[model samples]
Target: MKEMCPNCKSNFAAKDINNINKNSIFIEKQCPSCNKWFCLNKTLTIIKIIGIFLLLITSLLNIFNIKSEYSPVFSSIGLVGILMAIIVTFFGKHETVK
Candidate 1:
């Protein structure tokens, strides 16, 4: 997502970094050219989606060819986890500061 710097009117991408809250959150990045802080929430959501996908892949591998009798139950729970991740990552209020 592109946002125009309110200070200099220069456009730049927002960068996200870890915040104090345990929940996933958006943070603003300064414009590289103009040094103006702007929100990067949309960009951060994309990163969150990618991370979720990686988690899903790892969970699937763990569920494969397991000797445990509870493998099926574990796999089902993994599927549900993936679903929850998708919902939490994608089904939230967001705005792109154009």
Candidate 2:
């Protein structure tokens, strides 16, 4: 689906949204029509935050050499978080840059 610029209500091509850097949660995008800066909406921002936190926890488990039968579960959770963050980056709503 096309993304609409929150400021001007102009439609953005999916390719444009896909081209954005998904790795940086702090990145802001400028509306092509109005030039107003925007970022992901609060719900998406929170999801991204949680995803990062999960990934961090998983990484720490590896770094500290913590081993358990649930290690796979932790790794899977982290992978899910990363996937969610990436998916939301493209599909999430935009809000005025904070």
Candidate 3:
């Protein structure tokens, strides 16, 4: 599971987990913006997965420049992906180190 830091609110990427111990269930990350360390909650992982999956679809479409009568459907999916990411960023529960 990945999460955002409450201090600077940057997403915790898998690459960021490097050099950190992962023997425990929880994931820890240092915020790139605020330079504070925080732990990722397990619950929001589902939302993160869905959001990234949808975002991949949108990203692929943009890369290929696909457009047609079905363009609106793809556009809507992209919008939904953005919304999901926003929700995960702002609403999903993440532990902020005190």
Candidate 4:
């Protein structure tokens, strides 16, 4: 599990627990935005997964033309939806809080 740093709010990826127990569950992560260290949280990972899944479903529905309406408007809407999903899925990373 990751926790966001209460100070700078930077996102730090946590490595699976190994032999090293730092006595603290968290590590100091450098914030790309503010250059400060903060705790990372596992919630971010969950959110990213859910967002991508929804994006994939919408994109597939658009690709197969599953809907009965195959009009130009429908096609355009589908294309736009797919594009938006891709963008959000790939680049919707949360920025470090400053």
Best by TM-score: 2
What are the per-residue Cα lDDT tens digits for candidate 3 across 1-98? 55566777677675664445356545566666577766655666566667777878876776687765566787788779878867866666767655
Q: Select the stronger candidate by TM-score from 2 and 3.
A: 2
Instruction: Summarize candidate 1's per-residue lDDT along 1-98 as a digit string, tens digits.
Output: 44455556665453532222223355444556644444535655665565566567556666575556666665676666666556645454333244
Q: How do the residues 4-83 of candidate 4 rate in per-residue lDDT, one tens digit apiece? A: 33555544444522222234433334544455544334354455445556556656666787664644555555556556
lDDT string, candidate 2, 5-57, tens digits: 88888987756653244456556676666777777787888898888888889
Q: By lDDT, who's the top model here?
A: 2
RMSD, model 2, all Cα superposed?
A: 4.2
In candidate 2, where is summed lDDT lowest over 10 consecutive residues? Answer: 14-23
Scored by lDDT, model 1 comes in at 0.53
Looking at model 3, which ten-residue stretch has the lowest summed lDDT? 17-26
Runs in model 3 lying further than 4 Å from the true structure: 1-26, 29-38, 65-67, 95-98
TM-score of each: 0.35, 0.67, 0.49, 0.33
Q: Rank the candidates by lDDT, best first.
A: 2, 3, 1, 4
**Poorest 10 consecutive residues by lDDT, candidate 4:** 16-25
Against the hidden true structure, what lDDT does model 2 obtain? Answer: 0.76
Assess the local accuracy of residue 88 in candidate 4 as a C-alpha lDDT between 0 and 100: 46
Q: List the residue pairs that clash in candidate 2.
A: none
